[model samples]
Target: MTDYPVSNAAQAASSAYRLASLDQEFLLGDSTRGVRFQLEYQKAQEALRAYGVVSMLVVFGSARVRENGAGRQAFWYAEARAFGRIASLEGGALGGPPYANVVATGGGPGTMEAANRGAHEAGAPTIGFNITLPREQEPNPYTTPALTFRFHYFAMRKMHFAMHAKALVVFPGGFGTFDELFELLTLSQTGKTPRIPIVLVDQDYWRKVIDWRALRENGMVSADDLGLVEFADDGADAWAILKRAGIDAAPTVNNFPLGGT
Candidate 1:
């Protein structure tokens, strides 16, 4: 006896559409799905490729930082803004001779925007990798035309953020900020990335979340892991850390396309 083959739906999810639902499901045929995905992927690839030579400083922080506030909360925003400005000024006017010619940040509001604004104030090009969110993630107006990007995939975006990140400055924030910080630390810890300087601004605020002594006492992390990050009380110190990392100033002045290096 001869056996017949199963239908396409049984073989693949792409062919999940019912025969009667075909006309209502897609204006383009299922065959176009792979092509469409490839095209979108290429756009993302090109966007990542456009950022040439600029050393990235992924600024992670809260989006809810008040347009106005005081104390630690306010200080976090102020300091991040300052970090952006200093990086740009030193990297641009002072010449990033040994460093890449730009500064970059998450392309959203709060600390990210502050960092971008700081770079813009210093008259240096800056980048903003904005995430697509249902609310509160519009790309700030400060991002330079050639450097701004929007990403649907956070992992892809995070990869790009860490790709050339000469340093990382984490300001006080919520889950998202912490998530970014941990990822960088994990990468460095796992040897997936180099031991770049990781700065956490507002030591007091950060302390509330992590009990360093307990971490060590419990043997949850290695002594080397503890050394992976430094805490800063202000922007001046944060900028100083980056400067010490050979990103202080550079000789060149051209966009190197985002992931080229």
Candidate 2:
């Protein structure tokens, strides 16, 4: 029997047409419109795979943040920065390490850039999966060339983000940040993926989002559902929790003792 499941020639041609349109718009170059977004996206994904990242920590937060903004957006940036550093250390501790990097916001400014900058400061490769937006989104320069990416498809980008994620560190932000964070939660709650660690930095910021106690009281979610999310006051605390959860192996033996003995 032939491998082709469809024996109808007309049906095959129709399918090909749909794929061709998508290719021209999202996966292939269409020079007629002077847009190479799709090509750039594929290039970025390939680059990230080549950068030796076996797993990644997807850092989600505000992209419209100013260093001196109202609210705690700046603090969120600081927390993400620290989280990136912790991700690098966790990467180093794992056996047969493949150098996990913190995949940041993928934009030039805001918390995404901060995470990438933190990884860069620690001399680690970082991934910035930038999306094409109307404005205020540019690829941060700190991303390692082979670890940076752009995507024409947000869904595809989200898939790639979750693909190699060992953990997720969420910072306080707006709608987009909430969407990404909840989607990850949904996936975990539904058994779409293994129970990886999800650290929500800053209890004050996240406490307002949902009342777990209320959910339990109303029987919407089990008491165990609360276990799905852990809160932290800062980056170091978040790292501590994630490290203990087996997202990556932690160093068991003390390699370097106190002072020169």
Candidate 3:
């Protein structure tokens, strides 16, 4: 029998077919970043489409607010849960496949947990677009496993959030929340995306945190821009606003494309 050289075995091991997962040099290289982004978008889009997520009610809030925390934290959590429940039940999320107006969140603790928990309680499927943060963001237990997703890029994640959004309910939050809120607002303002109901929960909190009047006064934003956001004191109020905006708990055909297509 002829003895094969050791180099042959090494070369065969490095072949494309054998080195797929081990090809970190190509996978993680800068040249493949766009491919990575596309993969992330496609993966999430396919999963959501399989579940028939026609549209979403995007919920933005702080990950730090707790159910038992002091001041309005508990209230915010409870209200968020209630909103999720109401939206899920009314928005046709629990009815059947091709769920519409399902509650979607950042998939973290605090308000994200509350909203997801609410939808779970309503027996509705929910989506959690979790990100890999240095602080280690974990998907909230309440997120529907079939619809839950993890992403490395914030832009792609945000794209998913706004892609099929039918409405936005923003609770008091920190930088992360603000980032999401402003992104939607900018999209709405510029007509970059379709118009959707935008409700800011807790008028008092929002007024204090964001100087809407000041923004208009400074000529930084137009008066019509201020009209883009509505205030809701609680869950009921938020739901009412959404309803008036034509987002009923009833199921409707989703005209929006999946995965921000």
lDDT values for all models: 0.72, 0.69, 0.89
- Runs in model 1 deviating more than 4 A are 1-51, 92-101, 251-261
Q: Which lDDT tens digits does candidate 3 get at residues 1-261? A: 447654466656664655655687778879889989989988998898788887899999999999999999999999999999988888778777768899999999999999999999999999899999998998999999988899999999998888878899999999999999999999889888777899999999999988999999999999999999999999889999998899965555443444233
Instruction: For residues 140-235, write the lDDT of model 1, one tens digit per residue.
Output: 988887678776667767776676676788888899988889998998888777767899998888888889878989999988889998988899
Give the lowest summed-lDDT range of ten residues in model 3. Answer: 252-261
For all predicted structures, in order, the TM-scores are 0.77, 0.74, 0.93
| Of 2 and 3, the candidate ranking higher by TM-score | 3
Q: Cα RMSD to native, each candidate?
A: 7.9, 11.0, 2.3
lDDT of 2 by residue, 15-75 (tens): 4556655654443544533245345545655565465455677788878765667778778
Name the top lDDT candidate: 3
Residue runs of model 3 more than 4 Å from their true location after superposition = 1-6, 13-22, 249-261
